[model samples]
Target chain A: MRARDVVITGLGTAVAGAGGPETLLRGPVAGGDDPVTRLRGPGLRYKDRATRLALCAARDALADAGLPEALDAPEGTEGGGGPLVDGLRFGVVVSTNWGNVDTVCETSATIHRAGYTATSPMLLPNTASNVTASWVAITHGLRGANVTLCNGPTSGLDAVHWARTLIAAGRLDHALVIGVEPVNEPVRRLVGTGGPGLFDGAVSLVAEAAPAAAARGARPLARVGPYARRADPDAAVAAVRADEPAAPARWYVPEGRPAGGDTGPAGLPAHDLSLRWGRSSGALGVLQCVAGTAELARTGQAAALASAGGEGDDGAAALLLLAATAAGAGA
Target chain B: MNVLVTGMGAVSSVGGDARATFAALAQGRSGLAELRGFDRSRFRARHAYEIDDRPAPGTDVPLRATGWLLRAVAEALADAGLAGDLTGVPVLVGTTLRELRSVELNWCEGAPFDAARLHFGTALRERFGADRTYTVANACSASLYALGLGTDLLETGEADTVVVAGVDTITESTYGLLDRVYREAPESVRPFDRGRRGMLQGDGAAAVVLRRGPGAPAGARAYATVRGVGLNCDAYHPSAPDSGSIGRVMREAHRRAGIKPADVDLVLLHGTGTPLNDEAEARALGEVFAGVPRPPRMTAVKSMIGHTAGASGLHSLITAVQALHSGRVPPTLGLDEPIDEVAGFRLAREPVTERGMSLAQVDSFGFGGLNAVAVVEKVS
Candidate 1:
């Protein structure tokens, strides 16, 4: 079972609606702003709102992959006795740009209003940037090697590169990669000033070894393509010394399951997953990674997910590129 | 890609070093006590988890606890056994509160943007030779992210040795703001408890040392190799977890680690005990392990120490490491009945001594959906 291209199998998360693709697609990409929310957002009860969004995208990606049952344990497995994916290796990747920061603002405000003696006295845990991921671990039960990356701009591509590295190294056969971003009131205040106009969004995909996916009656996604990243520009260029023009062109996403999908560039191969997801926010890179998984789930063929981003000022760009040419060309 | 966690150090409310701190915690001893750091006659906060009565440099008692951060760093460096020039070392320190010392000194009106970036590094040139220092100002995740960055530095070979520290002590503005929000009785902090009033704005600091190349101190036991870290932003809202992509961060961390969900045995949670945060973290955790058999046993670090925002994550993680090594788990001081919204898991309230997997995961979430998680395992 060649374990290079692990495929996406099951996904689930909470968002604006119930944990499902259909429920999530109901619109309002960026949550609506209400004055009441603004006033009480800091100490609001919907703290982990970002986690809800993450769960929704993950769930939808799994459904898009045609493996609704994957959520249930394998046959004869004791209470999900088997791993998310059986003999096939498995891993996970999740990314977010800004985490929970409002708590600090609220904590500070409360402290200022009250004296040192009357501060709101609960253990406020909104300090670390990985709170959402920890919540996910608590929600599910998966406990593989966990990581949290916060590189701005290149966040999405970074997640893919990390996953690609693990896959190429024969570490895991499959990985559930997810990308998400939560829109907080304070975030809105910073975006127009400089922070990218963030659209609180989330996306996920169950990536698996191409060979294993093909063997499991599951149609394969695109073959893994040439993946590279231009780390913190000065750092990458300084360390690597000018290499070949960084594998020219953006990503190419093949339309595997989504029927009759083709939206390739002005000049490229035919047959693509009419890819809709491309401009992955550095944190939401997990979503962009799923673009490839979504395509594979639909068209069913060997596909390539080319993810590359430039650091520091190059305005970081990435795509869930996919393309299916004569087999054995690059794979 | 192996990140080694060498020379662990911390300055919790209890002890000045790792071993001392761990032993104090293991004995069910608490560092919390009467409000001796500052004047609280008008307020009802009679108790606080404060460090000893050592006076700050040219300062009086009953003052804020920001000075502890500077001293803690020095103590951590001493514990790590590093002496030579630290010009090449990378340093990342986490602190949530805007300098209370600077604030009480009447600098609160200073540029809001630059206000949070304040650090003691610049003032002390000889300590850290100004190579590269960044302050991860995220709320609770600050220190954890710094620890995670330390691991990232080791993994990416960015720096031979990365010094990671988390400091946030009792401050007028910090504690004052928390007090205004709660306005409750007994002024206690409960993480993952139903009747939780809110978080206590306690002051504390913690630090650790990471070495990659030479200059390795003798027998500086490596508690765990920081395998990987995951961070994501919820563009949804600055305060919430951006429900949509909360779980993605965990998925990324696990993916990078080349491990699976079922392999995790310990889940050091950021259960803030507040109604909203508890539910949010609970939901996010449930989503990631949506289809698993036996979920990992969950524990909240904030229960023991009132949430030290900037240092909570690292503090929680260090506590988890101590528990893993001793084959015992700490109880959530106030978690009696689980919140209805939180399901599918059990807390190891009583310390359980046993060895299995040695894999543990710690999570820290900051404002603005800034999420970070680290997977640590006891070295083989």
Candidate 2:
């Protein structure tokens, strides 16, 4: 099967912002107020914070994509079957470094302190990294290929890579890609010192095949292009440049580093979402991608995302290029 | 894209390697035993399938889980006849709990923290020197996801040879979580049996060396070809299996493999001995094979090896490959009386022989509604 062009059709954010994507692209979102606490659903009271955050972000992403609320039926629908997207064809891919770490820690602590019987069955499912993806699928009725990538900070990049691959393979027409992390005690402890920049948030984007986006009259946010991972940064940049010689107009690099010399177009305006959003580990890359897509949507230019330190000291790196599409013009 | 399984290795309770594990399965020996691998004084259900024949502690790696993975990788490499250094081979390891036990113990002891020692991906890269290493933590079906991802890596021209592994140690956290989640039966894990209790946790690791070809060289054998992969979520519940989704995934796998349900010769089930899962899976099998003239035979390995969590998928895949290679289906252990609803599908109560094997399916479903199915065929 020939590979089709994969485009981002929608965007949503639950990271430190109550107003969704706009608030995320703007400044801070009301002092890091958790969007999960505000989420409401059946049996949601028992769900952990991370699952709630993921669901809320998915809901917002579907709405942003002009799709109906996945969980809610339209007023005049019969048998409650009016959904904007095909549930079986729609998919979800989520990335998280320490998924529901707080729940795991607390559940283990409960068993240690109060005994095994005291551990809640409700909390057991959240212990796995894939549960957030599961909740998104279950709550939103996305029955297509569901996957969770846990490669630390670069996981979002991998998730996006896999999502596009699935769409290209014609397995799924659309995929909801999410990167989420919540500020929990365990994460704080693991990160050490309760780090100053550590924060919690979720980022979600709806990636669709070109034909599907065009048929739905959906506005394409950006055209995904040239994704590769390399052990050497020089090779990674070179590969990206070779794929698209124009070199991205904007860049998202690792925090605190001056972007130049093999990283991207020299002296092009660069931004670091990790620094502003606080290190969310797996969610960092998605935040960066969303920032880039937003930049492309806003400025009619392409953006490049690069990350160093793939597998500890292995010198592994990844570079992803996103160019603005005509449909995403003047957003 | 032809994905060849050139070599297979396993560090499981049934055996220290794939050969021994296959032998034990053929002999109908069970590996479920009382938990002695860790301190289990506070727990009510102490039985688990922990690897008893462990190599002595090594200085090069810190975590015992990593050691198991290294052993499996070495065996896989040697089995594949790959000599010299594998410096640039891509490695992907999947686990439900990625060194969380180390973190929990170290935190309890208030010891100095080193994330590399506990991070599975970093640990494997540091030990094996792979060019790229990734960790997949999608609960029980994670290794299947890794298998698909590894196959994708090969098909997409990322690497020629890829090492895919799945390992999870029986940690206190995992045990505690299971203990709270279900009622444990220490005597045995009996899937599809009327008197069955819940599943018993297991610890193990498996590695499969995959190459982008139809078969391997002389003397070195190719076990099977990964013909098709289909992974999806239940999208119904967090910990419960959805019958519709299960059937959909199986049909998808068959569709991708260019076969109908009737073409499947055998099935490796994710029969975890839980009532909810067993019934759901049975209904799914019935649904998918409803119109088939000859439904496939199904067997559960967890009944013998216990549920190995993330490693369960690869472990069962190795077993399925062995079945295809030997032309004999291993019996579903402890299934005294099979559940009537799925009886028409034919559970392998005893070792069954076949003249020649072709295609089989291995199913793995996880806690978070994560489901993966792979259709593998004996290289013709």
Candidate 3:
């Protein structure tokens, strides 16, 4: 089978105070609104916060991709059945660091305080590490390849890369990629509250085969480009540049590292979403990709580079995003 | 490009390494024993398949799973002739409850632990000097997903060598949850049995060194070539296995491997012994191999090792690879009265030793219907 070109067609954000992708481009805002209220149907009582956040972001991404009818059907409806694309061909890849910590901690604490009898059976399913990703797939009727990555620092980019790999391998024509982190009491206890910037939200995008996107008449937000991983940021950038030489007009750097300061390519106008939205850990890379998409939308025909991993990380990853027009013109 | 399994390692209740574990399976040795990791008096199900070799005190690795993972990876690397050096190789670790036992210990027993150890990347990097690490948490099927991802990495030239591993230590929280979910805890796990009660948790860690076939070091023997892996979500129920989807994924695996169902010689089942799961899997198998002239012989290693959760997939895969190499099909221990759903398929009640077996398929279905199936061909 021939390799397929992957493209980003839809973007969504469920970050607190950030209404949508446009708001995220400006800067992060602080608010206390409940992200669960954004959900469309019942069964929210048993879901954990992270799952609820992922569902909201998934809904927004599917709707943005012109598949609003693809979700929110009553439970037991096979494949979110509607007059749209086949849910079987649409998969989901979620990246989360502290995703189900609340449920895990709470359940374990209950068992510790009382006995095994004290825990709720309804909550048992949430203890599975892939609970958040499963919920998103269940709600949206996405029956394709479902994967949840908890890889450190580079997980968000890894999730996106996995989605692209799935599409390129003919496993799925479209994939819903999500990066989520919730900052509840459990997370605070797990990671400690010493850090000033703690992320608490979800970011999602729809990655589809270019041919599929065109067949569905979906407008491509950006073309998924070359991705490379190396021991450090400099080598990662150079590796990706070797694959695609187009100079990026903007750069989204990794967490705790300043843009263009010892990290990323020197002299490129870099943006760090962590400064605005707090350190998102695993979610930072996807958030950076979201920010890059927004930047490409603002500046017509341009390229954006998003790099993740730094100190305490195993390695660094660099991903390139080309504007739809630029990609079409073979830039 | 082919993804060949050049080396393998495993540590489970039955054995300390892959060959030992395979021997135990061939001898029909059961690992289920009285739970000793925690206070068993509080729960009805007092048995688990805990590893015999406990991590020594004051070990640099804080978590038991981490230690087991390091051991498994070291054995695999050495088996692949890459011992003491993992400079440019990428490591992918899959788990359901990574370091959660540490969290539970800290929360309940007031044990000290660093929070950063929750993810395995740092520990793996510091220990083996791996260039990159990815930790996948797709519930029980995580390791197979990681295997699939690693195969893609090699196929796409992302890495010359990749280590795919899975590890999990039994945790009180999971035990409690399972105890509550099961109405009555059976004395032993009996996969595909009519009177099967449910599954018991286990401790295990397994790893496989996958190298691009063309780039493999000279004189390195390949155990098996990973033909393909198919992954999918049921998107139906969180705990229930969907037979249709299971059949679809199996067919998908066959399609990706460019083989027919009849070509497969053996099947390593997920077979958790839960009534619903066994029945569902049987129905899916019946459907998938309905047209095959001679359906593959099926066996459930979980019947012997207990469900290792995240590590179960790799454990089953390693067992399958070993079976293909040795031409021995391990028995699904304690399967007294087979379920009616698997009427046509051959369920091994005793170890079957036969040569010339060329292909095998491994099935791992996790919680939330996260399913993965892999096709492996013996490298002669």
lDDT of 2 at A260: 34
The C-alpha lDDT values of all candidates are 0.54, 0.75, 0.84
Per-candidate interface DockQ score: 0.07, 0.52, 0.66
The per-candidate count of clashes, in order, stands at: 168, 0, 0
- Clash pairs, candidate 2, are none
Error of 2 at A329 (Å): 8.9
Estimate, for each residue in A1-331, the C-alpha lDDT of model 1 and write its tens digit.
3345433444443333223332322233445442122222233454455555655555455555454323224556553424334422444456654454444444444444554444443324343344555444433333332334444444555555555545554545555566666666644432322322345556666665666455554544444343333323233322222332222232332212123233334232423211232233434445434444444435544443333333222223233334322243223
Residues B280-373, model 2: lDDT tens digits: 9889888888988878778899988898888999998998898887877888888888888677777877877775768889999997677889
Interface RMSD of each: 8.6, 2.0, 1.4
Worst 10 residues of 2 chain A by lDDT: A72-81
Cα error, residue A183 of model 1, in Å, equals: 27
Candidate 3 overall lDDT versus native: 0.84
Off by over 4 Å in 2: A1-3, A17-32, A71-84, A194-196, A256-265, A308-315, A326-331, B52-62, B83-89, B111-113, B117-119, B155-159, B184-186, B214-220, B291-294
lDDT by residue (tens digit), candidate 1, B181-225: 554743455666678876665567777777763334475656677
The candidate, 1 or 3, that scores higher on lDDT is 3
Q: 1 or 3: which has the higher DockQ?
A: 3
- By TM-score, who's the top model here? 3
Off by over 4 Å in 1: A1-331, B41-47, B52-67, B70-81, B107-117, B183-186, B212-220, B242-244, B290-292, B341-344
